[model samples]
Target: MGDAHVDSEVRFEVQGRLGVIVLDRPRVINALSHEMVNRIHAQLVAWADDDAIERVALTGAGERGLCAGGDVVVLYEDATSGDGSETASFLADEYRLDAYIARYPKPYVSLMDGIVLGGGVGLSAHAAHRLVTERSRVGMPETQIGFVTDVGGTWLLGRAPGELGVHAGLTGTLLGPGEAIALGFADVLVPSQRLPELLERLETEDVASVLGALAEAAPDAPLLDERPWIDAVYDADDIAVILERLDELDSDAARDAATALRGRSPSALAVTLRAIRIARGFERLEDALAQEYRVCRRLHAAPDFAEGVRAQVVDKDKTPRWHPATVAELDPAWLDGVFEVGDDELRFDIGPGTSGIITGEHDDGDEGARE
Candidate 1:
């Protein structure tokens, strides 16, 4: 309704009754920084009470994507060069923002146009209306950096049909628009060419009416057809058992999945499996976020996280010599402390409203964006 306020990396504009947020750091694929998280949360809090704003929409600048994820290089530096308190604080704020998005009172629309992964998924997937295009490539690829999926990812992935969550979580598989919608990460399939029109119409028209006019049928999701083999191979909680089953299965997808899992940090894979399983029982997205926070704190202190980040991000080397080397070598007892509630447990204090907004102070540290 007034002049646009561009906060360096994140830009906000009120167009008529619609509030638009544009993640503006195209160089980093609009990766979320600590400052960006705080700014977004504060804006959401303000708009939750603004009568003029009937709906909110989130998108990204450039053609790359909405967000690549949280800036992991900063996280790498925090883990390797400093005490991990900064990383912990950043995650706490990030998670709080994600939880807020899940329960936002107004209609929250996300344009999942391009490479949405990790923190990107957290931002968009939890929205009330998640729109994906043919170019959309989404997933939670945290295991690649020896980190378990957070931002309420386990809650969404755990509820995915028949071990598909387990397969995707363990392999860090990227899903196309079709697979994303089929897996419940997205809703309508709108062409990239029509996104601008859709946005303009959303400013004045009802969300469902605008979508019904613009949405198209998504392409066939091949992953949905592979459920039999995927469910058979990934049905077990034990990574070793899953791997053995994969080797015994005849499907090439299963073999590829096993190979992918083998290359990941064994501890991360184990803990990810545990987190997803435990998340299946949780009723709230905040519960999964809290659990992930505990696991994340433990991961920040572990050696594999640093090594994984170094190999993947710092050194550009694909090889990471994990602590245990393989799933069989990982001691089952070692994962116990990772899920335990600690003194720094994440809390979502309900604010004085029906909007379910979290009221608290957040760390405003600006970490650079990560993919």
Candidate 2:
């Protein structure tokens, strides 16, 4: 099932009772495209209904790990294309797929082996069985790209224990398997060497048995000790306040965190803080994604996403000329405008004859109150 222009980058096949999804884009570390999202979503739906398929296992093609993220270069093109409708469509579809993975009934196992981030997190974090190997490095690095964590990043990151989510959201820090597990972003940690054997055994064995047998003991999370520091510095609701707090601390970690925020797009930092704060209240993952959709609808038009992409990806220059220059100069209303949208929202089609879930409210029209 390839898209019109290209062969299928995603390989979906059945091996005995196991339904497997192999992301086959080693060139870009398997960064997801809109076509990949649709194909993967369709396959998931097909496998979900197939009684012969007992479980699902997803992994990347090469050693680079699952996925780097979404194709932001394409996103940048579409977002700034003057007609951002395509970008919006892509976000809605991507989020729908993410929500589906969140609620997927069967054993949805994601092998997060290496360099998993942004879109990568969306694909694997919500699954029932999120498997990571020692080589895995995962995070939501959207802040650097002039975007908040879309693909239900708000829901996934917001729910992490304490203010760890805040630290991750603002800084775009990459975490190892141990750190990921400590942050609740990953489940079992399997050794990189054992992954091949584990996959072989998985074809014939139950997911639980295979994981239980091969899952390696995770090392001590270096960040776990920094929880108090993270909670202290990231406690503020405002990014400015958080930065001020970080600057006040004398520790090198605090200095590093502050420097990291200084380098990101100021607009993205503000929008990300607000998104995560509001997301903390949503009960359903769909609700959080909907809010993210509202932000994304207007996000592309902002000067930062394009400029950020140009400096980081297109031009090879590390300097991004972010509008307003600093967080204090950024208008609150601009960030507010990102969240304002009409009826155009994300809708999740679970299956045939099954209705899609609209964002913001349930069919009964009552909002699922956030916790």
Which has the greatest TM-score? Answer: 1
> lDDT per prediction?
0.86, 0.81
Q: Taking the tens digit of each residue's C-alpha lDDT, what string does model 2 give over 222-284?
A: 777788989988878788898888888999988999999999988888888889888989878
Runs of candidate 2 exceeding 4 Å displacement: 1-6, 349-371
List pairs with backbone clashes in candidate 1.
Answer: 1-14, 71-369, 71-370
Which segments of model 1 are wrong by more than 4 Å? 351-371
How badly does each model clash, as a count of residue pairs? 3, 2
Q: What is the Cα-based lDDT of residue 72 in candidate 1?
A: 93
